[model samples]
Target: MRDDNASPDEPGTSTDRSGLSRRSFLTAAAALGLLPAGGRAFAEDKLLTFEKPRAFSFDLLADQARRMAMQPYIETKSRDPKVLDQIDFDAHWKIKYRPEATLEVADGSAPVRLFHLGRYFQLPVGIHVVDGDKSRELRYDPVVFEMPEDSPARKLPKDIGYAGLRVMAPDQKTDWLAFLGAAYFRSAGELNQYGLSARALAIDVAMPTPEEFPRFTDYYLERSTTPGHELVITCLIDSPRMTGVFRMDVGKHGPVVMDIDSRFFARDKIDRVGLAPLTSMFWFSETDRPDRIDWRPEVHDSDGLALWTGSNERIWRPLNNPPMVRTSSFADRGPKGFGLLQRDRSFANYQDDGVFYEKRPTVWIEPKGDWGAGEVQLVEIPTDDEIHDNIVVYWVSEKPVGRGDEIPLSYRLTWSKDEPHPAEVSTVTATRIGRGGIPGQPRPKGVMKFAIDFDGGYVAKLDRDAKGVEAVVNASRGELSNIECYSVKIGTAWRMTFDIKADDPEPVDLRAYLKSGDQTLTETWLYQFLPEPDSAA
Candidate 1:
């Protein structure tokens, strides 16, 4: 929820250790200069320009990036520091850009609004409006916004430069597209709720070396000539390790989709680089509930990681609140798709109206080319609340991305409530953990019971009484007992029940999936069960 002082971009008020300060992470720079009455730059009606003159392709930008990588990295610095810092959370809300000042970057319903610089975002990015071979820079002006007389933003100077930019509808009522923070961007998905974020690239993430955050230093926002709503964006990315360029074609439908293409250049010897990285929050779910007390049942932006392999296998791994840092990888030749999904969409699960967790969007990434021989890596960090985005997934190529190499990567990002491709196979719906055995019947020595619900597909038409379903359960270091499977009456789903008795205090690796005769009914369910605590002798 946003307070009077917080910026509109704030998703929620969860504290985090993401190293981004409130001003830097939550708000873009928000102060501009006073323009002359004649509009010093040009009239509102001017065509935007690009290096290739409205040519919507990645070849030109990739060539620029490859040339940039041969040079050294240059950091950004603006004239004033105190003025930027003063635009903190509270002060940022006071520096809103006016709706009448939108730039028609495309023929779509959405118009472009530039963000000013504040205390946190001192680096100002240049915003250009492009059409055909014509392009012109959109000049910043302070008089456009309506701020209160006593507001703290009055102390800031004009011409400080804009921190970022956002895209609003033609009516200037709501923002549909936004590019605020470092290499991170998101559109209001089909549900109109912003959930996950997509990054230009990820370098040396989870590596021993300090993670390098590349910035999209400049952006060219172009409007389309055709009446149909279409816009083109060309961006330049820079970091200490590399520099790159990107061109994106954005469309608005039920869910905003971006056809993005980019090329990377390495400044130094590079070993690790993640293409099309996504960042999301995973606090707790049915499988990994928090120990500390809270009013709401669960808190998270996303619930599980869904992957579609090149072999056409669909895999779902429920996110967890691990005691220690964990990273998992699944190797593939050409992955069909992958995404971090917010599956538990029922409002009753959260029961909180303030922050609508049910409306958060799910992001799916579809590779444009054959990203041969790579593993989809998932990195999980321990998070106690919904603030910190502890879950990250990206495609890490098996072949190294080293110095003097230009890597061309392209993909389409889908922001929606469900995965891009629906599956005929059923999926694990719910997971529950409790003490083993009957209530008063001796409590079964060293066992703990687990109930897993699998829904979708032929699970509903299964033999209710004639042919009983089977539970193919296995544990790495435990004795499985009392395994059972039955049809769930509430919906067309099947329930698998089982118990495991560990011989020692060690982690138990468990895997199970339904199989009838020679055919498998669902994706394999994998779980890492930790040792249970002892109570009485």
Candidate 2:
């Protein structure tokens, strides 16, 4: 989830492109109009000397993926493992792409730059430019990149392909869209700061078995005729158990918008297939920090998972770095929308001016059509540091996908600072946990206290001593006591305080919402209470 180069201190291998040139070149050229005929034949002959443009279409790519899925999955091997190993983190940083070689598409709205192959990203992906019906593969060349003369990249062969690519702004300095490393891609969002990532497909994530990472083998980029329209990108995804064809219409006006249409074919039985899967980092937040390790108040790319269920209920579930991997599923018939959002936008909350965690983008997913019966699942993995992306959220259909089954999915991904459709009712602002007992009395042993804050909506209109306003609180398995709700002095936000008493050591699931008479005044707040570790043991 940390950009494509976020591998923990190890090296890997790249994918091979041995069977790329097997298709008929002359037939494809004739159909695509790449070669000139009659009078113009001699004029364009020099342009086609190196690589010939071939006829390409989305249907052709889908057919290729279908044919590949029928055959056994073959893992692409690295062409030069030793050379890639030498290009470690330090060496990789020094290898920069030349500015003059940027692929200027869409009337120069955003230029495309290739990412150099390195230790973290060893697999080489094919890059092509589609003009009209004809497409030409951008052959790998060393001259396009600048590196130190003593750099190990010089020792690699001339045919060493690129690892990934990024779309830079019109200025060609800052990158807004990037696609790199195992079907992973991210945008800077409206705030123009990269935070979380969205993967093409997720297989057996957070499961007992080792996770399978599918890689994008090839990419064909086409520019739009309209000046400000979206860029069209077609990609081929391959893995040991599946193959897919994805088409992304990507554009960045205020926020980055990606309209994705993909067809997936499973080669093996998958326990879970996460669609529109998002990956982020959440080390600690103000809600519950058992260990006050970091100096910053919070460290997270995304703070909570916001959901708009099929039943029209809006829910907010604060993310947690639990003691063990936890998977929470919310069943729905057809989900309206869901996303991992960084709601807290204040800079003072994070206090870190370097990375600007507060400016991180909120990624929202809006399903295009009826997804049928499915559940929005969130997987939280334990992490002590911010380097590892331990949080993942996605939609899993109730119906399972088996071998040879082709599933078509479509959705729109909005990378922005706020959720696409925010709840009309008051939302949970903050969640604080502490000792259970009163301040004057000795703290209760097997109890925990919670203080939740709600602001805006109808709750903000009420006075300090408003009548009929109530806090609806519940726990899965615990005694809830000492519940109080009142408006804070400094702001119009209402604070709800409560304590949960439990004798068991198992974690407790808690939910709370604000209500006035018979009307729900706020979105539901959910939290998982982890039992305090015994010091006497």
Full-model lDDT, candidate 2? 0.77
lDDT per residue, candidate 2, 320-411, as tens digits? 98887888898998899999999899999999876788988999999999999989989888777776677888899988989898989999
Lowest summed lDDT across 10 adjacent residues in model 1 is found at 32-41
TM-scores, one per candidate: 0.88, 0.90
For candidate 1, the TM-score is 0.88
Q: In model 2, where is the ten-residue run with the lowest total lDDT?
A: 23-32
State the number of backbone clashes in model 1.
20
Off by over 4 Å in 2: 1-50, 225-228, 535-537
Relative to the unseen true structure, what is the Cα RMSD of model 1? 4.4
Instruction: Give the C-alpha miss distance for residue 199 in model 1, angstroms.
Output: 0.9
